[model samples]
Target: MFTTVRQQGWVDGSAAITGITPYASALECLMHYFREQQTICKKCCHVNYNHEAIQQCKLQKVDFIWVNRDLENFSWFLQLLNDFENEQLTYLETLRANNVTSKRYIDFHFYFTSLKSNNQGMIGYAPFDLAANIYQNVSNRDVLTKMRTKTILGRPQWSLLFAKFKAEHRRTSVFFTGKPVMGEDIKRWCDQYQFMYYHEPYF
Candidate 1:
């Protein structure tokens, strides 16, 4: 299990944990700690602790985003196109409202080439069978390359597009959430990223 030194004097005035629960395994315990840290951070500081913590950990591993195997057909592509069109309209509205500034648009060549050469994370991609799919196909390098080439290049816009795509495609529900990283993997990732690692023994 895990034991955390609870911070006192929160705005919510919730009671802090005095004892740690005995989890079935180290992984379970760590996951619980992660969730607790996220909750405490959010409650106390209005921050997305999980995202911040993960980024702080700076794990350089290439995390995979999987699409639903059922959504691999042509119909799903059409749906994505429709969604993209709606997103385009929303973008135009934002532009017309003078809420966003326009910059010189670069074509797909510059975008895709950059992605192929750059070492940063890939954003969006279609999923395929892990065993049968090539590394690039499974890892979404191809999809991210296309997206970087075709879509707007700003971080805010890219985040919105990815969020919309994931929600509309039910990507998380079908694929990403299904394949969870185990406790050992989490510990290894934290170590790889140089995040603060802690596990206390039961007294």
Candidate 2:
């Protein structure tokens, strides 16, 4: 829905993209952000997120994330953003509870089951992976092709080898939800890989 307008990014350029990253759509920008974890909106792009700069809109008054609308309901996608923000807060609280100071949560990695060090990354999910029939969850719930992140277990989905082409439409993703997974789904994925935690939780 937010991909209707041309989206652009001024970012920490990688070899694949250099200077003035103009995303084909908002979803593309999201994919790039998940992979790079770098700032995506330095020049007032259409889609803005927690990790981005202050755009024309004041920070306090704007939505947690801002994306241009295009007659499609983005409630599910907005939920994704909310989850991302909530997870960040939870991580910070976890770190504080685990004897890490608020000013230095970055230096200490709180050992927990299936907890990511940072929550800026992304992951794709099948419809059933999320809900029985997610049609009831989203305005545009027609299944589409599988959409993935930049890495296997590194960051989000894919880059060169695991890339999803033209990652906007989530109307035919029966193979996968073509959208990022959230909440308990993330724990399932992290536990499956044992990538984000130690075998024994540490204090």
Candidate 3:
């Protein structure tokens, strides 16, 4: 069985980012992740003062669980995700958008470390997947650098690869509902997550 918990919570209103308004669907979730930067997991947290929160919405009651890209963290992360789901402690937009009709939107995935491995997480290859579509829209190394970042070993090389993949995936549909993300550093982060730009982009 499942239950609802009511307690104190925290939201970094000042730490807010711009993105799409919350829609209630997996497609919306995917689209929001690709378009907006509103309240992300990193800048938010849920607080409960009672055990009821943990006992509600067990993993068996939720949909799928996405593991991290790392195998070692996969199981642990799934359990953690389950705990959050059981407590109904997902993001506000995600909860409202997904729960209204399909309660299974909480499906978990992994952050893909390498394609060679079998392990996965909540969302894998998000950046690469997105880049593969609109890479050609990007023009020069300077613009790429201006758009993304210089973190990976081969910034120039990765940018080129990203561009190529995006060009191939250009036909993919994306909704630009939120604000436009600026800065090479921010763009780089979006690239890592597979978005050429984002509103209220995260680091």
TM-score of each model, paired residue for residue: 0.21, 0.20, 0.20
Ranking by lDDT: 3, 1, 2
The regions of model 2 sitting more than 4 angstroms off are: 1-72, 103-203
Model-by-model lDDT, in order? 0.28, 0.26, 0.30
Where model 3 places Cα greater than 4 Å from the true spot, the runs are: 1-69, 89-109, 116-186, 189-203
The residue-by-residue lDDT of candidate 3 on 81-139, one tens digit each, is 33444434344344455443323323322222233211233245456544633553564
* Highest-lDDT candidate: 3
lDDT of 3 at 101: 30
Query: lDDT by residue for model 1 over 19-78, one digit each (tens)?
Result: 122211322433343445443244565322333343343221111221222222324332
Estimate, for each residue in 88-160, the C-alpha lDDT of model 2 and write its tens digit: 4544454456565432111100111121222323334333334423543463332221111111112333232
Question: What's the CA RMSD of model 2 in angstroms?
Answer: 21.1
CA displacement after TM-score superposition, residue 92 of candidate 1 (Å): 4.1
Q: Of the pair 1 and 3, which is ahead by TM-score? A: 1
Q: lDDT score, residue 109, model 3?
A: 20
Worst window of 10 by summed lDDT in candidate 1:
6-15
